[model samples]
Target: MAEMIEYNCPSCGGKLEFDSTSQKMKCPFCDSIFEIDTIQQYYAEMENSDKSTMNWDTQAGTEWQDGEADKIGVYSCQSCGGDIVADSTTAASKCPYCDNPVVMTGSLSGDLKPDFVIPFKLDKKAAKEALNRYLDGKRLLPKVFRTENHIDEIKGVYVPVWLFDAGVNARMMYKAEKRRMWSDASYSYTETSYYSAVRAGKIDFELVPVDGSTKMDDDIMESIEPYRFNEAVDFQTAYLSGYMADRYDVSAEESIKRANERIKKSTEQIFAQTVKGYSSVVNESSRINLTNGKAKYALYPVWMLNTTWNGNKYTFAMNGQTGKFVGNLPVDKSAAIRWFAGITAVATAVLFGLSFLL
Candidate 1:
C-alpha cells in the first residue's frame, strides 16, 4: 500500500473535495465550503510546522525503475477514500470511483521546477462558450453530436513546454531571370537576361516553444500556438492551487529536432523575401546552421474537453490565454447527401426557367 491521506470536513467530519466553481474545499455530505487558505492555516497549526513548506518536497520523482513501486504515490480521495495512482508529474486529478478532486501537492514542489508559467486567463464558463461557438457555422458536423455532446470532461491544465532560443547562420543561392519582349515593324524581338542571387545573413530567434509532454499530440497541440511570450511570468507554486499541471517527461535534448525544423523553415522564408525584380527566381542551394541554442522549461495554460460519439473520440482544446479554439468534428454522411441533392434540384429549376425565357 502507498501513502494515503484524507481531508475530513472540520464541521461534520465528512470528506472534503476541491470545488472548481467556488475555488474552495467543499464537503458533499454537509454542503459546506471552506477556504483553502484557512484550511492550510489550520492544518499548519495542528501539525506545528512551517506554513511555507506545506507542499514543498525537495526530492520528489528523481528516479523510477521498472519494478520500483515506491516511486509512485497513491492518493486517497478525501470524499470517498478511493485510491488513485498518480504519476510523478500529475499535480491534480479526480478519483476514479467518486470523481472528487484530489491535489497531489507533493508532486509539484520538487526538482522538476519550471522556469516560467502562463496563468489561465479564462475560466470554465469561457471554455464552454468557446465550444458552442466552434460548433456553430459548421454544416458538416453531425446534429446528434451537437445535442448529445454534454462534454464528458473539461479540464484546465498547465501543459509543459520547452522554449528554445537560438542564433542562426544561413546562406542561400538562387538563379534569377529577367525577360523583355518587343515587336516593331512586323519584327518580334525577345531578350532574356540571367543573374545569380546569393544571400547570407544572421538572425536570432527567441522563445520557440515545443511540447514536452508525450501524452499530448504534437500536430494538434501546435495548431493553437503563438502564446504571447511577453506575458509570461516567473513560476510560482501558488498558481497550481486550483488548476491541474503536468511535468516534463521529454528532455530538452530530445525536443531539439522539432525546434530546429521550425527555425530552418523560418530562416529560408525570411531570406527568400529579399530576392525581387526578376521574372522568375528559383532556389539553387540553401544551408542553415544553428548556434547558441538553449532551452528553458515552462508551463502554458490550456482548456481541454474530451468526448466520445459513435465510438470515435473528439478532443477540443482552447488557448486559455488567447481564447482560440480548435477540434475535429465527425461529418454527417446522410446530411451531406441531402445537401448535394438540394443544390442540384435548385440549379436544375433555375436552368429550366432560363431556357424557357430564351
Candidate 2:
C-alpha cells in the first residue's frame, strides 16, 4: 500500500531510476549508467579483470569471498533510485515516473545471498502490455475483464533468484543391457560391463532463478521463464524509485537445494546422452561433488498483475526483466460456450454439404 514516489536526478536535474531493461541505475538525462553488483559479476570481474573475458573454470582461491564486502552498500538511486521505505515483503511495484513495475534489485536478491540471477531490462509498462496481449488472445474472458481490467494493477516486482556455479566431479559405475529382436522374438542381453568414467568440469551458469516471495505461488510463478541475464546491471535503489518489491519467502538454502536438483537433473541428462543406445537401464555408484561453488545475487524484474472476476482474485505475471508473460486467468465460461456453439454449427453445415455430395 505504499504510494509511488519520484525525485529528480542530482546530476542533470532530470529523471533517473532503475532500468528494468538494463537492471541498472541509469540516467535518462545524461545517460550515465552504473552496474549492479552480483557475486558472479563481481567475481567475474576480479577473476578476469586482469584477463580478457571472465572465465569460471579458472582456479580461484577461497579468498575470492573477501572481494565482496559491505563496502559496496546498496545504493539509493536518486536519479534512477529512491529510498523505498516500504515493508520488506512488498514484492510488486510501479515506477512513479513511468508508472512501470520497477523491481528493486533487493526484491530479487530478496534478502538472500543470491545463488544466481537474471536481471530484467523491460519496464513494468511493457510487461503489462505483455499481459494485456496475453489476455487479448483469450476470447473466453469476460467482457468486463477483457476491457476494464486495468494494467495499473501491474506491480513491478523483482523476484529474487539463486544462481549457482560450481565444478561437479562425478564418478559413476554401472551396468548396461541391449535388446535384439528377430522373427517376432526379443532377446535381452545383460552386459555387466563395469565401466567407470570421470566427469569433472566447471559449470558457468548465467541465471538459475527462484522466486523470492512466499506469497507468490510456485506453479503460477514458474510459468514465466527465459530472463535475459546478460544485460544485468549493478544494484541501485534509484532504479526502484518507482516500482514495488516483495519480501523473500524462499530461503537461500532452499533455493540452493532446488538449484542443485536442477544441476543434477541436467547432469543426468548429459550422462544419459553420453551413454546412449542402452535398452534396459544404466545403474551404479553415482556421486557428484561441487567444487568452486559460488552464488550471485540479483533482482530481476517482473510485472505482477492481479485482477478480480466475480469476486475471485486472478493473477498474471510478466517478467519485468525480460517481458515474459504468465498468470492464471478467469475464463468466461459463457463466452466459451457461445463460441463453441458457433463452431459446432459451422462444422455441421460442412458435414451436410459433404453428405449431399456423397
Residue-level lDDT tens digits of model 2 in 1-358: 2223233444675544566555565667698765534323543455476653322242344543573632222223223444333444553454344443433344344354333334456776676668768877677777888777764466656666555565666655556666554443566454444443434443444356665567666665567776666666555444455555554656666777766776767766665556655565565666777553556656666677887766778888876655668777777888889999999999999999999999
Pairs in clash, predicted candidate 1: none
Per-residue lDDT tens digits for candidate 1, residues 220-293, read 66988989888787775445545667777788989988999999999998998899999988989998989846
lDDT at position 188, candidate 2? 48
| TM-score, cand. 2 vs. native | 0.59
Best by lDDT: 1
Candidates in order: C-alpha RMSD to true structure: 6.1, 12.7
Clashes found in each candidate (C-alpha, N, C closer than 3 A): 0, 41
| TM agreement with the true structure for every prediction | 0.76, 0.59
Cα error, candidate 1, residue 111 (Å) = 4.0
Cα lDDT listed for each candidate: 0.79, 0.57
